[model samples]
Target: MAALSPLKLRVEGMDCGACALKIENAMKRLPGVSDINVSYGQESVALTFDEDRTSALTIKEKIRALGFTPISERKDLVAPRSAPVLSAREPWWRGKKGRLVIFAAAMFGAAFAAAQIEPQWSQWAYSAAAVISIVPFARRAFAGAISGTPFSIETLMSIAAFGAVLIGAAEEAAVVILLFAVGELLETIAAGRARAGIEALIDLVPRVAFRERDGVVERISVDDLALGDIVIVRPGDRVPSDGKILEGFSELDEAPVTGESVPIAKQAGDKVFAGSINTNGELRVEISHVAADNTIARIIHLVEEAQGSKAPMARLIDRFSAWYTPAAMAAAALVIVVPPLVFDADWMTWVYRGLATLLISCPCALVISTPAAIASGLAAGARKGLLIRGGAALEMLGKVRTVAFDKTGTLTLGRPQVTDIVPIVGNEGDVLARAAAVERNTSHPLGIAIVEAATARALDIPASFGGAIAVPGKAVTTRLKDGFASVGSPRYAAEQTAPDESVSRKIVALEEEGKTVVVLLSGKRVEGLLALRDEPREDAAVGIARLNAAGISTVMLTGDNRRTADATAGKLGLVARAELLPEAKLLEIADMKKLGPIAMIGDGINDAPALAAASVGVAMGGGADVALETADAALLRNRVTGVADLIELSQATLGNIWQNIGLALGLKAVFLGTTLFGVTTLWMAILADTGATVLVTANALRLLRLGLSVRHSTERNQ
Candidate 1:
């Protein structure tokens, strides 16, 4: 037995989700193909096949048999996501579609001229024109019928055209065929525009970079870059990968990757992302992430993944159309026989009306409406740095009525400052230096606050900090060169040596003000106390207010003390659940079920449980791997206002989807009424079917403009 080989094939000519589904079904019935994922949004098919049973050549042939062209070579099959190797595109004037349009239009024009020349020869001339145009297409319709889609749009179109000619409406039949051909060309162009909005992301990053290797600068492929390698980004060039600035300074425009149009000044120690244009000055950046893991690649992968999960509305529509097309075919058949057999109406008139009804029955407009809106929504959100994982999450986001936020890293700045230092047995500097020595090597927020304060004051602290040992959830103890030193909570200090009444009073005073106070101990005696507090973000209050205006309740969940949590939440006008452990936070998330659908927004790593427990999990852009990997959605701009923007985008997307659906059905209903009353003709029938399809797809494309409008709003408020 041979192992299964995975292949990604770039497929051309897929105009909508229905086209992808037809191809997917065909591949599934093939003996060797399995785990097939055909994505219309990605314009590609990913599937695994048993090598012994089927080869890639067979897969390509299968795709071709379904009418979608598989790109010609290996590079098209499995190229890098960020590679500049898009499948070669032929000009519209030279492609298969172009020739079809030319032939149909030329034949129609020739037939019309022939009718002008001789009135007696008009019927036969137009008949020949209709047959020539519709016959070639009818063959494909026949193939589709054999493949289980008996009532496909093509089949319906062919039937309508043939029925028109049989009913002695050859003039209308040729014109209808011409209209159909032109209408399909327009649909393809509009669909291509929608797809280009996403595929354009691949063009943001350069394929090569100027790598600095041991004092010699070399221009190399970005794929060759390894972690820790230094690359020099000149003014106007994109940073080749996600990295930290190692040398030089510059203002970088990160709008392409982050949607934050403001250019940020970056120097040594500041981070830079792939595809950000360095506006001014040269920067030497130390690569932090490989090419595959950079920002642009991840965004593309996420959007493609999102495309596979169809929206609920789309699924419902798919079910509706599955039966709707067959029912329409049945109605068309009955329309022809019912009046003629029972009422004894004219056979030609009744048959012509039945042909018009067949044209209206196609359901192509209804089938494509949902995915067009969805794909545009996904592309727009990605452009604005709001990454909704799939259609379900996008829909769910609009329904969220309550948003829960993690305190330390989410609502607050996540950077605490040492507010005050009090001495009990030594000067303030002496106490602070000892505290900083113990905390210099620690990663805790409060501990780093003290160390930062010491460094700001230029304290000559001891090296190695006496090999400090951390007591989880308590303190850090070290055997300093002078004597034993420690900095910890009052509870940990009390266990070592009890503080006097005066010192205890001061500790309680700071705690009452929502400041976190830690005790400094030297040789089992109280040295002094240090106070630290993290402030709420600048946009926290405004973001929460926007949600509240939208009728969404906001709350803060934190592991901090009650006073500290309350102080931060008060600024944002939200309630706070304080002093909760990780498990306690999970319990709180479950208890909030009564308020309706809720979204938990957090730093991604620490609040994974609470996020998972809620209706939707949102991770901040600055969050660690857990947030990006596990959250239902991520706000990649890392601003609190981005939360509001995401919700706004969600509502807009849902609204657009409904409008597209309505347009599809409403137009068909109007034409159905007209055809029955003899108020519509073959021209109107063609317009009703093809017109609705073009209209719905064109309407869905409007969502792509929301990216810029929403982005400008987010930037203005920030």
Candidate 2:
């Protein structure tokens, strides 16, 4: 709710820079924008805009339209897509350009040995090593500095290294170069972790699907699968493409899209999406769309765009980092130039103090803070089967208070089944037989439930029943020798005469119990009730309770009537329930935000818009591409309990991040005070700086072992 400033832009080339500049400028230029800053040197731009005036994508396109491709690299920075790929390795020197680290290390070691052995040989050996290291691995630094981009992290480090060498401090020069190499390596690794989940999302969709041709299923790629093309999908296969089932029945494991664990039953005419796995039964489907427009491809596009979409807070970091590095440089200059000139401090001593300031002022904490928390939080969520796309999403998840949920795939397991059957006049067996016969020709959730229920009961379906009418969003009607029969909800069977009031009351009672009631009407009388319901997830209630305990209010939002939604909410002990359509749900979320942040959970086509509009949109892996792409977080395990774990993990990871920052800053402050007071020597400063790096690095490694002992114990108890 805080007002922010638009970032100001001062960049060039930028056909790339100009593009990035325009984005930053637009952000600043917008109404309610407080300030803006644009820098091509760091390959990012920052903006402070009113959350009300412009959307996240509007800013992204402004950058993209400038013809500078925008990369999804917001630790909260908006950078060109061509900006260096963020590091994907661990939080060590491992992922930095390996050659650079090796070269810098070799030079540092040679210079250090020379300094220890002979003072006269020290200058030459150290300067030579500095030249060698700079020529090989620091060209970018020197070139970037000379190219009018004077404030790059690389340029700063290179300048400091040359300054040390110029003073005949071979040991100091060598160490500075080495330290810079390590910092670059660490930065690269952090960047890599930010990009890992998004890259995996891109890889999920294949380039092709086997297109069927004239009775022969040939392996033609997705591009060739035109509308109306027949595609064959066998058990254990991904749906060839997004299409409607023309023949065959199967159970599909659509975990990748819906994030549900159970397989959904599919029959002829059922719509199936690409990337869904057919767990059982073979399916012959007709492609409804080309590969480019398939559900899987759409998911890829959404994720890519979402990755490019910066979180509201990411821009703040970019702007802060831009000013942060230069501010530190200015502070270091004060340490050197001010003390020696005004305070009459010795040149070597004050200069050493300046070097000490430089050593710790790499903005290492700033660089590592966001990504370290993100990687750790993401890893923890993934361990519990949550696939968060990147840091922005991960951070947003922790802020959500109200949680809007999709009905079918998110809460009800997406596969409804008949749980009870009652007959008022005839035998129950006869009522079920007639119902199943009518429903056998349809593939709606209710129809499938009836058929499956009848099959479970071993009821024999009548073969001669004919004239079945499959009505969308209504009861299926068919003719029997006895009379006209209908099976559907009370509301859906409106064409039939009203049912007995007593029977209707009972049906209402059944509905209140969270059972989907199917009224069996014979002419004008209600003959029976077929109660169906989506099976509750095994751990849903437990998960909801856990979330409540963690201070996150749980909510169930559905398109179903208030009775059904309220019943489910009561059963699960959810804090809130909103029986709403897609757009209504979005409005509900908007209202919820008046109290606090909201996280929306969903995995259906109808859920996409709400997911996009929420503070943190969470996609169930078993959901559609629209939902997944629009969501800020993904529950890979498709379990409600995992969401609780994700929140807990994010909170813990953020705690760790603050601790690391405090440690880094505290040590630097103490070291700076000691160096200025003459209580610390140059060697001490060097040790302190390197030691702080090592400590932070060690602390970051804790993320690698995701099985934190405290978390493990908590899970065991749970």
Candidate 3:
């Protein structure tokens, strides 16, 4: 550390690229400066030099000589507390748009100089000018490497650039630094693309709200809205905050949150959130919470939290970079000083040899290797309407070999509908009319199904039916002309008294047929039978087959009977079936993970915990609250193959990442190996190193095009 040389300067009015370049060139012309990188971005200049030969004051004066003012030191741009906030950097030029003219003039000058000389000097000057112009921009790399505990890509690059200058291969040094600056600029653009999804979430919240006060309505900032305020939400207007309806009813289009194709009906006492739009009717909402406490705000907060959380593979990259940079630096130093001193090698040959070593060790490969693949894979999944919260979720999804599905809403249509009806002791029309009359006043799924069936038959239902009462988990009873009538579960119907043996057997047969049979009974006599069942989703069988083809097994979990569950699973090629409650589902996932990692797809409110407990939790977008809130990846289109596509994308992304790493390391190793053996020139090494980086980046980008071939391959399957 004591032997390390430093050259720091109060870099002057580098208000433009030309000013920065002019200072860099003047400093480089000095006799003993081994390396020079100046950053007007941070307003600092760095140079490694002979301690006795140069001073900070001399560098400062030379910067002023370039016709700019020199400052004492870099000042803090904002308060210390504000430093932790992730500020968006200036879009194109780091907020230096005013310097466009100077930068353009410098570029033209460098080009003109390149055209006027012989090939060798022209190349040398062109590279030097580029390097000099970018010095101020590149100095952050050098400074960060020095201050940080763990070495990064910037450290390797800094070492490489200095190694070239130390051995007096100024042309190679200039080219290496120039190439690095260009790479940094490119990498910035790629990162911005990766972060677009996160930035989009931040833009969704409303800036203002209209609140009602006294007898007049007032416009107020969204943040100022407090709990209990009455907010007037008009048709097509976003709900100002989380609140409950007080005076009106409408249909809210909650597509962004729930992904339901149809608008949801909202009436008095129904809840709505800050970003939901009232599509049809006006609603007076009594705000229940502040704007910051609303659903939209929580969503934004979760996204930011997830983005900051590290993916599993991120640590591996840090470990690799830590060792990779210092090792390259040590090797570069040996290549520069050892050959000429020990073997009496020609100075010029050794200098070129060292520069080749430095060029081959550039850290571009290591920097772009993992993140490029992750970014591309995430973008691909997003395009397919799958919302994977982070890279960690994607990694887990890739390894899932077993997927457990909740049968009620995931495998079948969640709501029950009438499929069949039979009458053994009464008129069929009379039985249906009696069942509808009993069910019309109830709100249960079975009741809804019966009422809907009665409507389909055009049965006349009176608006007001007297003596109607619902029995919890059983049947609903109503007064009939002769006696009370009850339509409910077979057990409840039979409990009043035993039915005829023939009628009981008929009910058993219907249960075996996968229908929930409810008998309409008057006192002890059986009147008729009503069959209800959840129909399977239209695409369930096709989706299951695709999963099987992709080598994944499917399991069905449900609260329904073994007979009904098995009947549904059989049609979809599912072998593992569990007729269990929500807690049992969680235990099943835990047990399955012991065999291998398992993924769960569920839609019920009870299924949320089990979904979260799985290796990868996938929520059908139209699912219940717990499922939507707990799942890691959500299929926004509610398509099962989307879950499969996410898995494929994760696998492809992981493959691309490993491939890029191998490509980068293999190419760097070959070039470095040849340079040490004295077989490679600095120019060839530079070309190979930078060229391999570009190739790896391009290969990782293929993940962005990832898709399921199932749509096209259906022709062959047919």
Candidate 4:
């Protein structure tokens, strides 16, 4: 069997969906090219080929011959994570599209002015303008015909422009050409906007960094910073790389990377992500990730790759455009020949009508409608910390009727916290310090949570004298300088000294409120009992309420005990299924598919299978690599309500695509009727098509506004 290989290439000149369709149709004719997806929004083409019959080089050459430039061909779909080359140094107005528009507009103006001065000189002047303006498209039309697409949009355009000129309708021909130049310029500008939005993300990282070595500070490129190198970030500076703070106390604003607007207080030993702004205090930081692999870099790479996959509607339009031009050309031939030969119409009049029909059937506006909106939607979502994998995923997100979340990390803040500290024999500080000291060296979740709580309170924790002895699922005991200290479950403490009624009631009440209770002991005497639980996030209830308002049902799946799951779910107003293994969660996701499309949000390695099983797998920002890779979308910020934001954005984008389609098809239908009835002229036909192109492009640009307007918090209010 021949191995099928996939290749992706960056297509620089492919600005419109019609161009992508032409390239796709031409490449598919090759022997071993089984499939191809050329995305105009992302400006890239992904194709699968049989290596036994064809090579990647042959494919590249074929694309080059189709009148487009293909660069940076790669076997891997993920492009380099460095800054994207979105624009050239020269200004856009001085580029090829600009120069062509300037020349054509000048000629048109001269022709219009000549008509008033000398009516006889007007036709020649208009003919010259039309001839010069159409030369480039005519050449490309020839190339397209030689390749596989004989009736491409460019070919239709050339025939319409040249036919009008030969028939002595020179004034309309010149107008048609000028309109085309303007339309092409509009498409070029839109292309820049699509790419520029992504470039904005890359601009967040400052180019220079201040590295301090042995107390001497030197400025260097951010890329030069490596692992373990200490860098100094002053107030008002953006953190250059992901690292831990060695010496600093200040409030850091992490709005850029995590989308949290409120600044978080930070001290030494706290971790910081690249692109987050430092609001106050000078900090000494040790670099973690190399420049190319920072969190921001990973996000940009994901967005670029996501743009390569087109939505179902966009794909449908691409295929429709391939055959639509040829069909329209055939219809045009029938209109011209059947009228004069069968109905005895004038030959000259029929010829002019046929030329106008060609312009109406170009399909340029129809083809570009879906992709332009999709590209804008993806860019907008990325800016707000919602990262959908591709257009298909974006479309799917809108249709999801049920959202299943993993409880531990998805609903609640995955870490346990000390909620209540009761003192039976001494003060709260004395009980907490001795408990933290006994657990400082233990590697358990509860032990770590206790130690963190003590550290957070700035309490002194003495080091353990020696190794601690742990009883499985019961208690851990260590010898202090005075005697033995123990921290464990209530039953473990009772073996030493049974709890009285007062202590028993406190433990029971805390347990009823969905907390884990542990007893603190000094020797055989009970000192106090602490209550802990994984607290629900502040936005969990509000996010679920939004989903409920949108008619989406919410549920939680977790491996934690039933009591703990119910406690968290009750507060969030969601249904709960507890103590599920990985396989069980996968089975539950399959069962939920009967309701409708499901979106599974998870954050651990065990959630990979379940994430993949759902209609769309969504990962939390702090998810494991396996879970992140398996998921189709991600909330890059730790906002529970980003799920609602993703759904809303998807619906808005889809609605935009439908509107663009209606305008394109509606204009063609109306103009086709008017031209056949002799109610419109060649210039009017071209003008209407140009008008549709402008409307579709302008409508797609609105998605960028929706993206920019995306809320930082999931609660809808900001």
Say which candidate scores most in TM-score: 1
TM-score of each: 0.91, 0.65, 0.65, 0.82
Model 3, residue 581: distance off in Å is: 4.4
Compared with the true structure, all predictions reach lDDT values of: 0.82, 0.63, 0.65, 0.82
Going through the candidates in order, what is the number of backbone clashes in each?
A: 0, 33, 3, 0
Off by over 4 Å in 4: 1-12, 25-39, 44-79, 106-118, 418-511, 516-531, 621-630, 708-718
Model 4 RMSD to the real structure? 5.8
Model 2: per-residue lDDT, tens digit, 175-260?
A: 66666556545444544444454455444445556666766667766666788988888888888667899999999987565444
Candidate 2 C-alpha error for residue 528, in Å: 5.7
Among all windows of ten consecutive residues in candidate 4, which has the lowest summed lDDT?
A: 621-630
TM-score of 1: 0.91
| 129-167 per-residue lDDT for model 4 (tens digits) | 788878877877877787677887678878888888898
Model 2 CA deviation exceeding 4 Å by range: 1-119, 135-138, 146-148, 166-168, 182-310, 379-384, 406-408, 419-444, 451-499, 519-529, 559-567, 575-587, 621-630, 679-701, 707-718
lDDT of 1 by residue, 112-160 (tens): 8999999898999999999999976787687566666677777888888
Report the Cα lDDT for residue 237, model 3.
87
Off by over 4 Å in 1: 72-84, 423-442, 454-505, 518-528, 621-627, 708-718
